[model samples]
Target: MNALPALPDSPGAYRWFYADVTAGEYSAVFIFMVGSLFSPRYSARVKRGALPLEHCAVNFALYHRGVSRRWVLSEYPQASVLRQGRELRIGRSRLEYAPDGTVRMEVDERCAPLGKAVRARLVLEPQVPAAEELQLVPGLPHFWRALAPRAKARLDVLSEDVSVEGIGYHDGNHGAELLGARLPRWHWARVHGPEETVVDYHLPDGVAPLRVTAGVLGTKSERRPLLSEARPTSLTGWGLRVPAQLYSGNTVVGTPRLLESSPFYARVEARRDGLDVMGEVADFRRFHSPFIRWMAHFRTRVERAA
Candidate 1:
């Protein structure tokens, strides 16, 4: 409906970072984030001169064959300062940003809960210039910046010395604000085609009074707005929906196949207007606290979507 909001003048005031890598029919998602709320409760605490309240969390997940192994660490660090940077470290794992605009990531097996040791080292190189920062709300309080929408990745992963090397797709996002506070629900998907990459976000009526859809198509020489109509369809097991098609006016441009589905997300392989698509889409509601979901008037049960 309405045009997306302008960029926030002070995006640096908050803290967040996310990086995702997918290769050889498997994918990894990593996130480091700090969220602050300035609600009446927080304001009252501030009036009483209480310490600032915030939440910090780190999440790393690996997905393959309808199975996911995730490590989540969350805490409320009282009187601790939160900072944002190109480098992030949690436990034995680390993600670093290099001078050449590449991101290097290393994860230790100790972070995983069970099974043999799983270790990884990956280098992500951007294939196109960064997309313009997009402000999701009117004040740009929270935004999504697609870095390396299409990337070439070199990865070496070992599970008890068994190693695999392959190329993959890389993308990232940085934002400020409690996601649940900003929108009730949304669907996001990225397609890494042979010659290009396409990314899309669909904010349904629950996220806002009006439906909002935004996306980008990235090629070797340029990144442009995706003028096609894209939406999720074909509900699979566990209620996961796949990105059914991309359309230019009334003409179909692409179609996608469900590759994997979990409790709150799904990965797909798509063919869009002659370009191949491989990516994932997620619904955050499933990840929220049970109480929060009840308060938000949304209902979800924890189940294996695979």
Candidate 2:
């Protein structure tokens, strides 16, 4: 089991646990966030010297046949979040890990703008062992780890009659300072096969890229791109360019289809090839714009404690 690690408590420090699972015709992704890296509220409050835990949040999305079925991005106050080594709870939802490498996620959240319920229960069993943590930037406190690069997952939506089983992934990132304050943009992709998984992350400022391959044998990671190859791709409606096709090593993974798009970020998936890619062009820098911060409110929901 991979328990939650010690989190930083300074203002603007952030921590988050992210997981995604893809099954036949259905897929889902969820995250538990402290400091809420993408939160407009966090961005504003941190400037005022507020604690990172004060802006915690839970984000979950369910998809069917490549279309978004239910989306939730609910932010909570510091009083509503509870963190422990083996468990972390936000509102009525929680994430728990067992000694046998089983991870269970309980989600009871609501869609933004409207308060519609989006409840789900997901179970993930790690098939491949956890990998080591790597520092992203030099002299920076930010770090990332692929806790479970490969896992067997099952999902059930409690709000409706839905259940499925398939491949899944779990990872985490923690930092003592704001992510955008150090990096301008990044691109990341994960390609999976029956037994092996590959993760490629691109960073700016000449920092080395993180490429990892994990399976039963062990975990192998590279810090640099194999060669100077940047393939051409198209631009999103929001002006963010993304990779149309993903490559790991010398193998052509597959073409990607856009799942979500924004002025600073893009999420694409090559479901046929068993992989997904997420990219951020200028999220933090543009986030400083007043107009951009106002736009973010529409994508988030704020629920008061009962």
Candidate 3:
């Protein structure tokens, strides 16, 4: 058989944040995805183009602390297109709405088709309130920075140089789900700037040890660690913590099964002083784009080094 056209295969993760600004407080969520169906033989890839609807599930729950009458503003779809003097440069994406009222985003790097690299951008509407100030960490890396109104956030991981700028949102009016969890076609995300750190978690049932991945990218520096033997058991207000549980996955172990998943809320402790940091985790809405999956058929690489 004639060799098929080359398809790009790359692994990366996505981070998402949700918050309620009208209520004076908010929550954050991060998701890390590795491997793809195009190549590298990803088990998570849906068979016969079947969408792994379960894996695509994105749900967040927020607890009100200081404010009451908390509610979500609007769930819309946004697209970030780069242009230079009326000419499209690169970068594009579509957000989706899941049945659980959670949001999912399918990002596409269009520059690949034109033989260029694309940087993904997250666009928030002006109607959405933004933090008024920045919170500077004392001892962490110089790049770490924090901002107020921590409602929604997302992370775009790229192996090559990419730019994230000039992002804007569009209306996501996709129909609702009747039952179970359906993939999101569009979404709305809150904005919290500077950046903190990247985190990694490994479920005992993970396919590979080093394959466990998670992280936070600040405006300055990025933190990423391989989760050796860890998994996020449960999540509560202010933080998502890892709990002790039974992890089942082995060559002789047959298929991995959850004997018991420990329950624990999210809590941020001072890595140095062992102090609990104040925070919250809440549910917001977003959408996924069919365009993202279409663009994934191709891959883009950075300009070669000198």
Candidate 4:
């Protein structure tokens, strides 16, 4: 009968570093993540005189060409680590940072599903200073989130024989618990404008007492919080609901266009306040157990504006 720690102290605690790059009409997202989870049958196994243990994994996802092609790689128990605040490597692919504040990412992955190799080399230079870390949940389980809203990127993708040079964004999150554990439902979006960037995060029922409705808007040199809102409009061909409008206070600033949709998530690009908004909204309940999904179905309703 002891109290569990608010955040896990083990090295195997859940955490992830993510970066996203977009240029013209092409985009790519990268994730270097690790997590530890207890088996759902732990109680049953313990009752049968078996020790309850934890499972850990290192996973990464690369969404190429606006989510048209996605490559996922995972290693159990994690085989990679961040070194010197500069390099992150898993297997052979790695993302590194230079002393001059430039980032380089080299990818050479053989994807079995595509029956081919996906290769790319990308360089990103910050066009603005890093933004202050945004705390999703204030205390105890405070998951730290940070953003670099704008950067100039030069990319050469060997797989598609495509080359792109333009602006990009980078964000990171580190926490002791999985995101699903912290926030059951939320909508996260990022807008890359001609001169500035905007990030809107909404958590309806996850953050407790006060609904989590916050936004950051600014250029690289400056940023300010804004009053914002998000609403899903209609279901697209991919079966994911599209946002009708993104509001900054009482004015509609963006209109969403679906870019990709899967069983539980949707990626969209919107024209917002004369800028371009691109990001995803996901429903984690579908990925959970059937009981959890059923409970979610009863407790949540997908709303659409008429």
TM-score of each: 0.61, 0.92, 0.23, 0.68
For each of the candidates, the C-alpha root-mean-square deviation to the true structure, in angstroms, is 8.7, 2.2, 18.8, 9.6
lDDT of 4 at 130: 62
Q: Write the per-residue lDDT of candidate 2 for residues 65-156, one digit (tens) a residue.
A: 76887888888875333444788887777888877779888889888868688889889998887778888777888888988888899999
The local distance difference test score of each candidate is 0.47, 0.77, 0.22, 0.51
Error of 1 at 233 (Å): 2.4
lDDT of 2 at 144: 83
Decoy 1 TM-score against native: 0.61
> Candidate 1's residue-wise lDDT over 48-68, tens digit each?
443322333344556553255
**Which is the winner by TM-score between candidate 1 and candidate 4?**
4
lDDT of 4 by residue, 103-157 (tens): 7767665542233566777777876666665556556353534344677888777
**Rank ordering of all candidates by lDDT, starting from the highest:** 2, 4, 1, 3
RMSD from true fold, candidate 1: 8.7
How well does candidate 4 match the true structure in TM-score terms?
0.68
Pairs of colliding residues, candidate 1: none
Query: Which of the numbered candidates is closest to the native, going by highest TM-score?
Result: 2
Candidate structures ordered by TM-score, highest first: 2, 4, 1, 3
Error in Å for residue 105 of model 4: 2.2
Instruction: Mark the regions of model 4 whose C-alpha exceeds 4 Å error after superposition.
Output: 1-12, 36-67, 73-76, 82-85, 112-114, 140-142, 206-232, 235-242, 246-255, 271-274, 290-306
